[model samples]
Target: MKPYPFSAIVGHDQLRLALLLCAVRPEIGGALIRGEKGTAKSTAVRGLAALLSEATGSDAGLVEMPLGATEDRVIGSLDLQRVLRDGEHAFSPGLLARAHGGVLYVDEVNLLHDHLVDVLLDAAAMGRVHIERDGISHSHEARFVLIGTMNPEEGELRPQLLDRFGLTVDVHASRDVDVRVQVIRQRMAYEADPEGFAERYADADAELARRIAAARALVDDVVLPDNELRRIAALCAAFDVDGMRADLVVARTAVAHAAWRGADTVGEEDIRVAAELALPHRRRRDPFDDPGIDRDQLDEALARAGADPDPDPDPDPPGGGASTEAEHDAPQQNPAQKGKPQAPTTRPSAPPSATFRTRALRVPGVG
Candidate 1:
């Protein structure tokens, strides 16, 4: 089915950005979208899948985990059909296997059974799945982007499971009349004729995918300067986030944010944005303390860390083509170095090696 176009989604810019960031670099782990029923959480996921499909030229299958799904069905199970037909007990892969290299989205995740949540958390953390059931043992790589949606009114997730997710984005229905109207009109337009609506935004979706692809290519080169690393650690310390995961994730996320903006290195601006997304959920929980950051304090700390305040130009728009690497011996796509090349430096010719060595043997006292 054609999904509602991502660009057509009315507002919730942060929600949309978090989802896209997770997609661009799954290593940042998953994003937990918390909101009420009509906040377009699931719609955003489907749109992301569609966006990935257009970007990578594959379906980018989105495997939905049903609330009532059994444990065996979720992890893996014995192949009854294979056993009966061939007299052999084979291990049948489950949702985790199918979700490899795609997305595993669970709506109402807070309401899922404790066991099920544990299973997912284990797989997500390990980046692989191993199952032993009914005398069948099998293990294989299973890495997929994880997304979970929840309504706080329904329940709360375990702290353990909540921290498993790399990022969290709280969403609510749009209160602005114009935005609400646009959301409704877009929904109606999509429902009225899904194909046409999708087709209308095809170019924009493709552009978005290319932009993500370029950012993915460029992310590895977007280094964090020593000051940025210090800043990341300082931010984590300020929040009193648990473990080293937040520090490492914040560093990597700053790199990604810089890459997304087509910068060659992580900067203060990237740190601010990355900290907002990476540090919020990881903060020590206090009922009285706000879950978000203190913008003023963050700015002060960043300045004290000697962060550069220079603003960069907006990144170039993605071109209409696949932004993939070339094969061996072929020229690199060099997405990070997309726009320009620097002037090459040259060295002056040196004197003959034998002549230089003989002449350098004289001591200062003798001379």
Candidate 2:
């Protein structure tokens, strides 16, 4: 059956963006999709693979990791049957090898064996797999985008494992009646005529794929300003996250966001969007703790890092092209609004006043 077109997937803006970011910049690590069943999670993953295939003009297939797969089957093993027949042991590539240069998707990943999960995460982070079994040892590149879906009600991954994912998004069925109706109508239409339905969205998928390719090519050249670096670090620190992984993930995610926006430099909006995607899961102090950062808190953190949490939009460049930080920061000159004075913007480094003893301002407890 034809995979549902990614553009046709409805009402999953964050999920779509997270998957695209990982596709454009795999170094940002893979995304973990947490949501209920029947929320189009699996469909979205398959569609992303198809979209990537269209975008790169290659067979970037999607390899599903079965729930009951063994370590040998997942990583690789010796071809015992071939050895018996030929009297020579040979390496047999596994799912990891088969998924090279594409996407390795694990459904119900939380239910998979902990050790298997470790193996997958290890390969994802290191971009290589090692096999040391049946008196034969070998290593090969296993660089592939890792995407996993899980229902939080079934179980939760250990914090150590959870922290490995570069980005995550929570998805839920839409509550709006109109959206629900549209989803059902689309599903029925696709089921009735899969080929025709796919053809209708092919152009859109191709256009998005081209954009993704362009972003991937430009991501390396996209500048990460010093102020943006400070903002990323301060945001992670303010959330009181466990370690430095959050900081690094936020920085990489911000750069990817800049490239996605066709911007030469990372802006405050890019950093903010990066934080929203990368920081929520990392900030959970306990399994039961609600996962999210307060908007005011995020703004304060940005302010502390010398950024305008809510800066004005960049003016359109003459003759039409990507916008630069210089253009965004430069004062605007619109004759229509020239008579009115614009509000002053400030971006100050970590001021001493911003740093004060919390205890000093605490009121005496009446309890």
Candidate 3:
């Protein structure tokens, strides 16, 4: 099956960059792409998987974590069939095993079970799974890039697990009429001829893959200066990020971004970009406490310390992904404005991947 080409996908430059940074440096953890439904969040991820596979000839595919999955299927469990047939204790690998050395993508992740979220957090952080159940000791290397997509309307991820993701990029639908038309035309074109449409973008995709490969080679040499490192610490301090993990991941992501841009050493611009990706999810979302890191302070520090502002400070979607699914799925037809002839926009529902898992566990505080 042909995937929507990564290069062909429109808008969300920061999202694309975050995906690349994760690919180049898996140590940076995975990216959590939050957006409303039909914003091409899943499409971008699928396209990324295809592009990466073609670019690196990686046999491992993106492992989809379907909502119907159980604790046994996701983590691992005793192989009952093997134990019964062979009369010997055996362990059966789960989705995590299959996702080894690949991408583990979870759609509508915010709606998933808390326990499931907990399991993922442990494995992602450790880069391995150590399962000890029923006197069956098991441990193997299980490292993969974890990509999760969610529509905020369903719900928000717990602040604890939310911080686990290395980078977070919001995805929003294009408001520009021209861009929207281009998106639709391209979608129709691809649907008509997936192969031919992919063929058209093949060169661009290949070039991007090559660029990623080159970045991987140079990531080791991308180093940060002492003063710049201090700035990163200062920024984190201003934000009052929970732990050193945030401080450390920012540095790691910045270095990878520098390498992605083919720069030998890290730069201020790289740090600025890294902050945007890493800080949002990490900073304490306090409704009351407004910290003193104002734009002027940030600008003054940048001026005195010579930090370059983002070349494209604002992305195309201007507003990032609409977190709530209601934005796209729920169209409120205002009844007050009668007979204005506003055509209701309807999007085809995606085939049910699993029996609506979100509704399974309700009663918020209950297990």
- Return the top candidate by TM-score: 2
Rank candidates, TM-score, best first. 2, 1, 3
Model 1 TM-score, all chains together: 0.79
Off by over 4 Å in 3: 285-367
Task: Decide which is better by TM-score, 2 or 3.
Answer: 2
* Alpha carbon lDDT of each predicted model: 0.82, 0.88, 0.83
lDDT of 1 at 184: 87
Return the top candidate by lDDT. Answer: 2
lDDT of 1 at 99: 85
What tens-digit string does per-residue lDDT give for candidate 3 at 43-140? 88887777666556777768899887899899799999988899888989999988777788999999889889888877877888999888799997
Tens digits of per-residue lDDT for model 2, 37-119: 99999999999998777666667589999999999899988898999999998999999998887889999999999999999
